[model samples]
Target: MVGQLQIEVLGELNVRRDGQLLPLPQSKKTRALLGYLAVVGRPQRREHLCKLFWEVPDDPRASLRWSLYKIRQITNTHDVDRLTADHHSVLLIPQAIDLDFTNVASLRPGDLDTLDVEVLESLAAAFRGEFLEGLRLPRCPTFEAWRLYHRDLVLRSRIEILRRLVSRLWEYPERARFYAHAIESLRGDAASIDLRSEAPDASVSGSSRDVARGNASATANRAGQPGSELADASAEPKAGPTVGTPQARSQAIRFCRASDRVRVAYALCGRGPAIVRAAHWMSHLQYDWESPVWRHWIDALSEEMMLIRYDERGNGLSDWDVADFSFAAMVTDLESVVDAAGLERFTLLGVSQSCAVSVAYAVRHPERLSGLILYGGFVQGWRKRSPHDVATHEAMTTLIREGWGNSNPVFRHLFTTMFIPGASQEQMGWFDELQRITVSPDNACRLHEAFGEMDVSDLLSQVAVPTLVLHARRDAAVPFGSGREFATGIPGARFVDLDSANHILLGNEPAFETFIREVGRFVAETVQR
Candidate 1:
């Protein structure tokens, strides 16, 4: 490619070609228009562009054409198609432009922990100031909103990158303190990124006003506290689809349709060898990101690997209106998520009911997986186990059907107690609310029934990949014998007994540390082999 175009909007609006600074259109509106197209990363309609820039008193179309002419002077070269417009729409080819904003645009919340130390330092140095510094268009409200919203996104990411840098550079205290003390004043203004602030969503077909608003009202409804693939949109076509949510800025929780046509939600984060955790239990991708129970789990796991997690078909952020609750369907959910994520080779992680799902997948697609990790899982469902277990499941079924959906925490507490008996009041309360909110009462019972009938014992021996089985010694939900069963049944499976009663593993206890330490070591070994 000849005549490379580079655009930097992280701090200032600087456009360059092949290391030579280029002059831009004198009009602030024209420069603002260029900034918008460069950051949006997609095609925009001509009429909408006219509305975003030119008002009715002016010849909007003629003015837009003039701006496009000026923009092309600086952008398109080397047959790169960097600036392209047809009769209907105009688009900037993001691939052709070395936009500096993308450097931080790609940084998500959990990403800093996984990034190399050098990479972290490099990213730290990239942030010069708020995005598009001093390029304020007070007259164009839509453009102003976009600029301000993105400024917040960029500033928040900058703060997080600095925070991670401080933590990582502790041995180099002088440098760490330099970043710490230098930016000590900046955090008060922008550190807390209010992701609740909505951005415009240019619809497939909408008027210029619609384009200008980007549907802020709609955006407010779609955007949750942080960027949740669950709340904003469910499905994505590929992995590493960048978003601006706090679960490391871009750990996009997206969706894909299963063969059965169920829309399954999944989140992929961090930067390393992949580890796909088959969805199990009550996991809301949005809520769990900030929750005490699952947040640490996600943070620790994503630290060393590109962790992929999903909501089940009938639970969490996945399509909850599903009909298929069969054992085969459960396995298929994991398959669909992994495929949607575009993972070539990953160590599969299975917890609780998903253990059976992971085992079955391993047997079917041994070449696609490096290893398997099973925690607090069972070889046989209650129905497939002893009569006492079946009886207990039958009793639990009655309780869930009646009170699982009730406002009272009594019924939910029963399930929560079993999973994390050693949990503090706060943790138990979070789990209680999660159980009630994640799934409907009918589906809760259905999930329980489906898990109870999972006869994966026959498939356990078929597991071809290396495996690790961990179970809390005093786990009240699933017996200690259950984890032992997986260890014995799967060939070359290593087992460890975590000394805790909690099935989810609270952060306060030593078991959580052991869990992380073991998983990290196992993953490292898997990467080497």
Candidate 2:
């Protein structure tokens, strides 16, 4: 007896029947054609498929015929009628096969709020990944256009479901945050979708919360099963179970006094080898885990290592009203946090001005560090780079002092754009709030001034730890040459140039993927030694 036919087009394209996987055609164009037909869910003209997938081929019609024959050969083994073709058109018989994409496409906005919790959970699980991930036909412009449009449509639908789930599970903050994380992972910022706007009278029943919790538990159980595609599902959501998983929960905030007697707030999360992030100019130990701009980093890094992040002496949950905001104090803060965290040796991660602080620490305590990873770092600060930078710094500091906490995001927008030019509107909004709440206007100016005057050029050559330097090619905050200069100063340091404009990597950018992959590899190699 033939079993049910199921087509999965979420993560990787696959066709299964009777609990058996079917081999697809070797040609990507053939696979693309099959996926498009299944997703389009209607009869397509034979000529249209030919033009879409083989537009650049010399013999488009002949190519299509060969592809169809190969597809038929594969499908005929399972069920010949799975794919139906006439002389002029072709279609995947809807009754013969079940398609995840079609099921997802059938969902409406109202279903998100009104549907049973179990039903909503099933719909959420259906979205394993972006539509047709890693399936690209270089020369097929028509196919590519259609794929993008369909992908966007699926993304919108997924976002709507997630938004409504979050609203409906309002009392269950853990589940709400889980969906929020999924929404952000899909590059659909949850903040952009106002839950209130979606369902004004949305209310969750006790049974609904139980259903959602059960769904989360089921997801966690599936996360451990062998051969599961959990990693590829949605940017490593399987790294942990729910948003309230141990790593996602609030870390215990501890205070350590610096040499200058200023209190520095720090927290350690996850479990593995210690990896310390240098306290940059802006940080909030409490809000950072939930913020859109930083949560991705927190989640991804904590999955493999015990990530230690902290607020500098004058920002976030640290002592904001401080007497000192100098480079010496910054280094002291790092030293105190390291000691407080009780790390004999750990990997050091630094970005922006904190790169200098990290470099200085590595130099002062070479035996204390196992590896160094710096992004968009510079040995010399803006004022010391050139006279031009001095004037620019002065102007920026002036603006921060004058319009730092204004209700209007105009002044803050300038900083946000330069830092993350590719940030979504939701990200921009979160960053603006972070800036205002992280530190006062006076502290902002002081921080920028301190960054401008920072000069660790002489300390670069003294670094003794294995180092990896990364910089965005078009980083607006730090010049690409400056990053190169930093690498050049350190003997045998490796340098990677990221193709991005954002100084701070955004979650959705291609550069972030490269960054994470490389960093993971580097950390693994370093620990092996």
Candidate 3:
């Protein structure tokens, strides 16, 4: 009970005195300042800290004083000398506190070679989440920038540790598989861990030679193609074979320039007739591949047809600082991705708001599309169809503006519950984190408002391609009745009602099996002709 103070900033900002948890200040800025000091591990000038956390005319120095006073109140109660401040600068006593990130940063490449498996596992588990996960201050751009840089640093470090474990334990396949899954969960399908290597020393440095080889093969494949240079330049690292399943591979992420010069990030997976998914909100190509909420769709659909998906402009790995978040801009993103893939004809799949974009695309270019699949979609958005919901929409927008990017997941949980009411705690947890990291709060509010104004009822009747519409019978996000109306507008569109309350079906649900079977059947029947 007399050791050093412990600070945890890997997942949540937490502190403990003598191994007993201590309560922190209620103010977010106060906790953030403490975290900044702990990670920076040196004295920071008062003016620098003030400008980083507070704006001008706000008495930043006074704000800093109050935060420092709060820090002292918390730490001094336990008689701990954890924080030090001078007239011009402040610092956290690194020797008096144990930090998770600091321990991880101190690890060397050689440590992985000689460390006991148990010790290595403990180190890996220390990185509970992204560095200061879900912590954001809308007014403090400098702090946010620092957080992002450190987040990436911690992420790379975690990846290296997992890679080393997989390599060092290559003799133990089950043990290696365990670490491989950990890497997969973190990096999604973007992870490049190979368990087949006989020599562990070859990977001691934690390099990804397998990924290099895959990129080489991809480069050779595109060698003679006209736009191959552009494709190669845009191609991200190709994911290697996963630990247990050799066939489960992720497509290399590539960028395509939209007509407006915005770069759109997209990925193509599996091998067969192409199936293009319209860009949708709350999607990250890298993260979604391993997400419990979206991985089922990727796995099932990619089994039969080559599945292509992309982040729409202003979301995910795409250009987030975009000026356009309109329906027109989203449709253009779809167009650019398809043209870049050089597909002659493909089936189109859309979910949620992107359903309207898919409808518009199918209507404008019927010959380029073989079929359409819409799930939990509506022709008219909430504002366009339901005047009574206007007040609710505005309130939701206000909540997003205020609470979207905070560490607490309550704001995001509101959307998650409506989308997947049947989700397990694990699924719900991932969805909550997904929304926060997918895009900025400003973009979230902007996208929300933009989707509300979408009115694609006219485009529905113009859709000439073969279509299948599947909707949960009791969807909370998009009503089941809207799904019926959407299907009825399109000529010869098959409508199926899934018996579920969740807007998006979970993988374990019976409705999901039915949804997947119906989709495969419809695609097979339509594509043969």
lDDT of 3 by residue, 201-319 (tens): 32321234332122222332343333232333332335555322236565656655677767677777777778888988888776676667888888888987888898878777676
lDDT of each: 0.74, 0.72, 0.75
Collision count for each candidate, in order: 11, 0, 0
Candidate 2's displacement at residue 216, Å, is 37
Task: Write candidate 1's Cα lDDT for 1-529 as tens digits.
Answer: 4588889898778898888999988988888889989998777778657656676789999999999999998897656678899988888988889888897877645567799878988887877777888788755544554565467557656766665665566566566666665345463443232221222222222232222222233332322222321222322212332222343434655555676777676776676888888889687665576566787898889887888888887777666778889989888878777765566688999998888888999999999988899998888889988889889889999999998875455778888888988877657766776785578788888999988888877888888888999999999888999999999999889999999988889887999999989988888888677
Model 1 TM-score, all chains together: 0.56
Clashing pairs in 2: none
Winner on lDDT between 1 and 2 is: 1
Off by over 4 Å in 2: 1-250
Give candidate 1 regions above 4 Å deviation.
1-250
Best by TM-score: 3
- C-alpha TM-score for every candidate: 0.56, 0.55, 0.61
lDDT of 1 at 18: 88
Name the candidate that leads on lDDT.
3
Candidates in order: C-alpha RMSD to true structure: 21.3, 17.4, 13.7
Alpha-carbon shift of residue 165 in model 1 (angstroms): 45
Return the TM-score for candidate 3, rounded to 2 decimals.
Answer: 0.61
Q: Looking at candidate 2, what is the lDDT of residue 24?
A: 89
